[model samples]
Target: MVELLDNQRTFHIQVKHTSLVLHVLPTGHVTVIYWGKRLESKSLAYVIQDIGRASYISDTDGIKDFKLEQLPQAMPTHGNSDLRTPALVLEYADGSRITNLRYKDFKVYSGKERLPGMPTITSGEEVETVEILLEDYLQQVTVKLIFSAFYEYNAITQSVVVTNLSKSNVTIEKVVSSNIDFLDAAYDVCYLSGAWGRETHRQVRPLSQGAFLLDSKRGASGHGQNPFLALADKQANENSGSIYSMNMVYSGNFQAIAEVDMHQNTRMQMGINPFDFAWQLVPQESFYTPETVLIYSDQGYNQLSAIYHRFYRECLMKSSHAEKVRPVLINNWEATYFDFDKRKLLSLAKEAADCGIELFVLDDGWFGKRSDTTTSLGDWQPNHQKLGGSLSGLIEEIGQLGLQFGLWVEPEMVSPDSELYRAHPDWIIQVAGRDPQLARHQYVLDLANPAVQNYLITELSTLLEKENIAYIKWDMNRNITDSGSSYLAVAQQKELSHRYILGLYHVLEILTEQFPEVLFESCAGGGGRYDPGMLYYMPQTWTSDDTDAIERLPIQSGTSLIYPPISMGCHVSAVPNHQVGRITSMDTRGIVAMQGNLGYELDLTQLSTEEKLLVKEQVVQYKEIREIVQLGQLIRLTEIENQNQYAWLYRSKDATAFVVSFVQVLARANTVPKRLKLAGLDAKAYYQVGERICTGSELMSIGLKLDKPIEDYAGQRWLVKKIEK
Candidate 1:
């Protein structure tokens, strides 16, 4: 037997019959190994614990028939159940001895760059040893992980659950979170508990160089495996970027979702921090905490605690007076491309308002010298050739149709030919000798420059002041290139990232405070800049540019796991999805978009009356239950990974709710339940929404069981709203 080195001083746990060593490495890798024939994998023994016993229910639509046989057998009733379990769970092959001695067989490595030499930073100290204090949670089964010195691995991990059983009072404080890297696992998901899911806010204690860890979405081919997450840090990242992640999980119910938008935690890491109850352990007592993280095949924040709470409590959770309705918005990129004008916009706005839209957003072309990617980004002035009048006048006209006006701006970018760029040629993030590469007609602005930041702030403020815009679609089109800046010295260039983000934060802070009511939605070329940082200022994020309904099922599905639908900007675009060229049915598009902060991104003026009426009806329906869809408990009724069959659910605390199930429908089989084993129903009660009443047992067992034709759409849903108390 070989004894492993406890060099990091991370942990020393002693059980009655075993000893465990937990340590972290310089590469930001953590190692947790048990000394005996480890009994890994969750067991039914913990059934007395919350996870094994927590009840589940749903009200979101689309689940009629589903089989439990396809899911993993683990009893993950509470916490983030979908995160990948470690390979450490696999013990020895033989069942011989319980272990008199021990053998070490674990090695997890993060990406390491063999730089010419280690970096010298004037900022702080070089890490020496990781410190961990372990106290067996009274031996019955609890371990408290008391750690100092936040490491890199902390950000990349979400699957850590430590049992606390110490006899004396012990408080674990988060001093620092590390930048750890992991090898992509087949499956990984970081389920944020409570406030952790979105609107990430880490008040003061920031895991530097970090973002909220939403669950990982693995590509389809590898069987729900998140290939990106499986990646250990690549050697290439050694010189510059530093990535940090935090596992902010809270305990108990309603802990998996956010209660509000922009509602911040004491910590302000995009307000994406998780919620939790303190584990007040007594003598021999134990508390179990499950954190959200991803290591699975595929899966997948804002700030202001008040705004966040308002969003949830006011907009999403309010079941009374027809959910106050965030205006149904329409963006024009999917509608007109580069071929629209004032007349075209007004026409679309008219159609949209008739169909119940409250806001119309003109994307990309109205400002600067832009027509296509070849020119004009920094000139914030209106493109007079394209605009018939002053921006404010056009905005007022759009508003006259009973809709709010919105516009797009990429303040952190500039076109070389733009007026702003010509005047401030030194503002771009580039070396004097290097020719900056452009993406979508723009070069990145050096926000790190204090002067540039002030200029952006002034221009942004002026533009808003002059316009009647109610919303701003703030966009960042590209990543940093050349990694060098004239504004930053050699040492300062390394500081660019953190400083750049700080600069962004400064710019948004000024604008948001100055214009408290204007809603700003962050768009990073669809998704490139999606991190909790941006969400702090802008509660919502435009998920991706590809808006096809069929394509969105997976995207929306994965996004829903970590972010509330309200924060995911899903829109119904023109039938020939400009991105994919596939024409999805309008109803199908509406249904998918309705699942999120619903809107239109299509040329509505072209729709037939029948389709227009359908859209009108959808708007009415969304207004009616947007609260239920946004605030209620979310559950996956169907297997998310199975493409042929899709299912999900949401519900209020009451027994009444709905489910949405999707299936192409093939040959039938009785082996699979035709209906749901609908959960969270009180076995003792009877529920009646109409003359017909359902016993809890019936709903729990058969769930209004029915068998309909495979292609039957309406047959897939079983809406059961409760009447009986």
Candidate 2:
């Protein structure tokens, strides 16, 4: 609920267990007085006091004792007495960059307000919001800081809308979605950072006096740095201590930063990466920044992650398959990389159907005479000659075999050897005089162009309308380079990156709404575009292209830091593992893949009789626990840093069952077995695991024992069902 104490000039935005109190100073600057545990509606003006003109800190508004530099400001501005990082900076036509905004007005609303052209929390309509308006009268600019509090999700969404009310054009040099200040800097910083094939590795360090930046300037939310950041107490862990986290609902270039000022206070900000980014606002035009989800939990990282997981599952995702049990499918990427004929795919699909798989995904090379990745990206039409039939004919054949059909298409990219690019070379993002750089032998489509958007909609709609496609692996295999749009004017060239993301969101919005029942799983090579923004359109993402079970432990574990397990699309692939060449047992691979939405990605026809039987049994096992594994509350049973053994627990929504998955990456000889402690079980309930019956208390305390004399890259999973009286 959002409460405004007008008499005391304070606004309190409260979720279920958290509260953010904002107080308007006598000089009209809104400052955050408190933002931690929930507090009642009262005058919090006394919570903040100035340092009274310390060295290098000057007075403001003729108030000797109060200075903007020392206060925990709500909307800090540039070129002001506040010497720390400003949340906003506007450049005017006269080359002036100073913007001092004062509180002008405010509004309280019942339901959450949606950002005009962005992917955000829209599923939850019962959220409360308080929008505080600040204006710089000199520049005729108004900034609205919007805060939406989600009661059930225990989270808040923050976004900014900057409007240019002046007659002249204004340039927004920097504007973040949210800026929060903490009175103390005694916290540790945590973020997800890694490279391609190894995305979302958790990194943590103590927050010192300087600034720490987690950003993605790779045009995509690069695999190098994900758009998630958290501040935890010095002694924080999975189950204890205070934690505050933020994730941007955006897939473009973004920045999440924490700056420690000289006063030992920490300032946290998240939004579009200001580096090489600028947006021009014409008169009467408003620029809406993307939304950022903020969550605070005193129960540490697990609680913080639970808030994000539930919020994303309930509020962010819009696909009809969001809450359903995902189909167990096999993608033909690794099975037949660009070298499959109609007969080859039919054989594979036949074997998959015999193995009880529910879906058959025909990956690349089925379109546009595409024998290799160097050609035929933008051409969505199927190569009927190569398929020996029409696209629908092939799909109908697969469907007759008791499996749904899925297709892979890299629609956002254009191969230079394709017919589409030949007709419209200007459709690619490129500067007028500079040669466009290519990644993976393809150029990114100029998504910012309305012409391009309409063409994609028309082509994709035509194909999807004609064929009974159940799922689409929408992949963008390369990051954007030579970032310039032909449709945009020279002055707006800097807006191409964000504009591309907005355009992508628009196309996805229409297509997903049009085909609500069709499951859409996004992939950017694998996991590079795995941000909350994509999850809004596509229910899940291909977790990583690296399908090795042992290598996936840290990747999936770190990704689950902010994303739910259900949103990860994990698949069991061929042995010698393909990516890392680490040969693991088929049972271990199946158990690891079951941690998320289960699938297979290898040549099923090549599996031996025994291996094929194992695959069938794995399918049966996954179907039995699919719902609980997808919708359950996930808790990290062990730290992601534990290289020897890693474990996690999932409790059913009704708390009637629990599943724990553990993997031993490398077994040590003559070592004692380790015990895995579980969490979030009904303390009084008794659960039956196979033949063993144990109370929840015993499960949480004495724990489950690991298999002794463990083999290399071994894994195990147990389903504990409550024993009713």
Q: RMSD in angstroms, all models? A: 17.7, 1.3
Off by over 4 Å in 1: 1-176, 179-325, 653-656, 659-673, 685-692, 704-719
In model 2, where is the ten-residue run with the lowest total lDDT?
49-58
Kindly list the per-residue Cα lDDT of model 1 for residues 177-265, writing each as its tens digit: 21122211211222211111122111111222223333221100011111121121222121112121232221111111111112111
Worst 10 residues of 1 by lDDT: 114-123
What TM-score would each prediction reach against the true structure? 0.60, 0.98
**Superposition TM-score, candidate 2 onto the true structure:** 0.98
Which candidate wins on TM-score?
2
Most accurate candidate by lDDT: 2
Note the Cα lDDT for every prediction shown. Answer: 0.48, 0.89
C-alpha lDDT (0 to 100) for residue 315 of candidate 1: 23
Error of 1 at 424 (Å): 1.7
Tens digits of per-residue lDDT for model 2, 27-100: 88988878888887566676775433455666567866566777888889899889899999899999999998
